[model samples]
Target: MSKRKKAPSGNPANRGLSFVDRRIARDFERWLAASDTPLSDPHNAAGAVGHLFDITKRSGLDILEPSDTADIADMLLDIGPNATGMVDLFHDYVHFRLETSRDPRWHQAHDELEDVLDDDTGISAMLEAIITDAETRDPAVIADALAHTKVIDGVTKLLDWISTSRPITDTGALRLSDIEPAAAALGLRAAGARTLPATGDLHGQTAIADGITYVQSMWHLEPLAAWWRALLDTDVLELTASRVRPGRASQRWRTEPTPPLDVASEVVALVVSDTVLGDLPRPLRLGCFTLPGARHTCARGPHPRRRRQARTPHRDRRTIRPPCRTRLADARRSRPGRTDPQPPRHPIRRSRGLARRLCYRPARGPR
Candidate 1:
């Protein structure tokens, strides 16, 4: 007699008792029917279902199967509610799984779905998930994940959206404090040790400084343009196109035009008296003395001529006189008794009370 084959347990083709039984299928169908929106609603649960259907079709599945439900839900969640059919199917599958198995793995699977769907939705949702996950799991692990999120992009998008949708108001301005975390997250630093001012206090000076700081930290050239505009509105700085250094292409930079020598001298005097003294670099001091038509020559040590000039006192006009010219006959007639000694041979003049001869006589012999 031929050995009789034992009746296959459950459906032989399905391989043992499957989770996707008639009951589960019926439950899923009822959920799908009861859904308020159709399975094709663009913004509703239908998108999710459609995505799942596509995944199932691609997987070569003829009918809804037990093992494929969780994975299909995961895939639908990955693409998010944008895929209506996939989301719808996933929602039904989730409800069916919850009723049938009540397994803890269902909770994990659902969380994964939620994460993919809610990412980039908004800061509130992302922040809530981050804070919650941080509290429940290892803080470092959750922090790592949070750091990986496109937080800066989200913030910039939110700010832009708010600015566009809402009317402009004092409160709409982004405050330094409000953006501190985002700036830190983006690894941007303020240029120096100064803290950025609040939005309300951002005037020309502060705005220029902030722009410079941003450029310095991020190396982005865009902010520099804004900085130029801000500087133009303020007298504290001036922008000029100049050959900043020789042999380099000329460009605009903030600088002060040199004042006249007299005015600069006053300023220097005031600064020297009011400010704490420090050794000025030789080049800087030399730069300050660059006056037009004036020459600067280094003296070899101390000069005796300069010292003599400094010591000499200026003479009065009355103390200087030209020699007086007189004829010998006139001198004899004016002072006949006084010039009796050969008529003193030459006319004389008194200068600074000292008698000086006005005319010269040729030397005679060796006398």
Candidate 2:
């Protein structure tokens, strides 16, 4: 008996393609055939989908087949969503898998879809939303979301590391040495620390290179930007920048001597009352009053929001503190029974007495 020829899965030979799908498939096949396709181009999900749609139309290939689509997704994942020419393509392909594939592997694609959709909105806001969602999402759902969005782990982890530090203080002197280990542990791709040319009035400060993944890692962008902004806002950093010549070849970080206790105390008081201080993240604001080993105590005390215990308004010339006991004791010893201290007496000026005598002396003619 002759053996029967086995049919190809999904009946690929019989699959029909639409005009647009065919066009997209033709372009994709052409792109795949090319030896050099720059991968750095930025495109959104819809654009990526449009490309894929054209590919399907041109090739008459059922690219949406679950197994084949899964393989496609894997290839895109390895290339990364930020790869030139790949971001939108990956996004579009994943969306297709989510909509058509029955494979459980693609179910979490919606989470990634949400993120890809959010890419155009701005990385800072996008990352903040993701972090907020992470706080509320089920552990399994978040894990799946993390798995689906390849860069989410690195992005969120970097944000986590940044958020954990006191923003302004820690960021003021941020170095690669401080961030590298954590970045490595979290799988973040941190660039080498370098000195940059002065930006405007600001001097060349310690700076971290923004790798290609910087944009792809949306959640980290805001915190990183905020950190740099905070560092720039530092008075000491600015002072150091003012002192250094921008074109210097030697890479040296300029540091200001720690403020003396009185200066630091005054600064703490000034910071606590400033409207801008209220706007800073609590962690950053909290560290502004740091001293060697002890935190500077604000005379006004903690949070500005809480109603300060209703202090009696001081009347002009009114005494707030009682008279010193030493003065009272001396006054008592002088007077023998006085409870209140008498005002100290002032000796009459000898110059004034001499002038009075000269004015009052009757015609003492011949002396």
Candidate 3:
């Protein structure tokens, strides 16, 4: 039998990227240079935005923090339609141009190069450049510059796409096909955005963008939990909450190890809600309630009455007896002079009686 040849590990730094990959990277670099966004340095802006996208996607929320929402809303309002075009164009280049290139391996090489450019070393120069620019720029210069630019509006739309339960289409935009995947991922019933009319008092382009914005915002703000609570104190999100695992859309359950039974009992699965989950510690934020069967897990803490009962301990004669003691007490009641112990029907109960004789037998004075 011949051993199969292993594929070589590809790296841009060691092996050097293909000419096509380098060209694509340079194109991306030029795009970043031409932009004037909130974060003057494109690397930092991309990093921050990418982090926000991931968190938003995982938690299924539009606004992670309420205080930041106003600032974000204002930023988006400032970044007009032109900025939105820039974003769409960039996504087109990344998703389509590289993938459709003549060289079969060009797509894989381009993806690898992009990943490297996102690293700390790749971004270090950009960070230093920001510092140099800051000497002449105003205090909190990035935030100030961003506040004035229309960049946020476009970026927010991109984020809206990322945060949605929908999967990104081949074109990097959400499609109707993505609805089911999105629903499964975020535990939301996905719906298509309402179609916009052809023309309006505003330019057709502006009107369409505004309509998209409105529809996306409307569905995102209204969580299933909030909708349910409005109708009743409790509501069912799904029938199989226990069987539902993390990364459902991605089929992560098939590979990821199921937590032990004891650990599973302690696990608290995260739900999609309006509340800020980003504020939680990482572990707890990801934990989902493993409610077996058709049970609906309560979000609220323990009941006040239960808390009081737990704190106060009392012994009840009928219920509190140990197996051995209960058997002895029964035997004493049943016959006047019978002191011999009766063997318990079950092996476990019999073992307990034998253990009782060993531990608590009347002490035969120094015997």
Q: After superposition, how far is residue 360 of candidate 3 from its true place, in Å?
A: 43
List per-prediction Cα lDDT, in the order shown.
0.30, 0.32, 0.29
Residues 171-279, model 2: lDDT tens digits? 2333434445334434555432333423321112232343322221211223333322222233212313112111111012112222222322323222331222222
Model 2 misplacement above 4 A: 1-84, 116-367
| Tens-digit lDDT track of model 3 for 122-174 | 32454345435644654354333433322221222322343423333332223
**Candidate 1 lDDT over residue span 1-367, tens digit each:** 9999997653232232235444444455556666664642433433343334434444333234333333344333323235455455566576556666656656555554454344334333433454345347653553344334342123223323323222211312123333333234334433322344444233222323434333211112212221211112211122223211111111111121222223222222222211111111211122322111011111111212111132114422122111111222343233211122221111111110000000011111111
**lDDT (Cα, 0-100) at 361 in candidate 3:** 19
The true-versus-predicted C-alpha distance at residue 71 of model 2, in Å, is 14
Q: What order do you get sorting by lDDT, best first?
A: 2, 1, 3
TM-score of each: 0.22, 0.18, 0.18
Tell me the deviation in Å of residue 263 in model 3: 10
| Comparing 2 and 3 on lDDT, the stronger one | 2
Which candidate ranks first by TM-score, i.e. highest? 1
Give the Cα error of residue 174 in candidate 2, in Å: 21
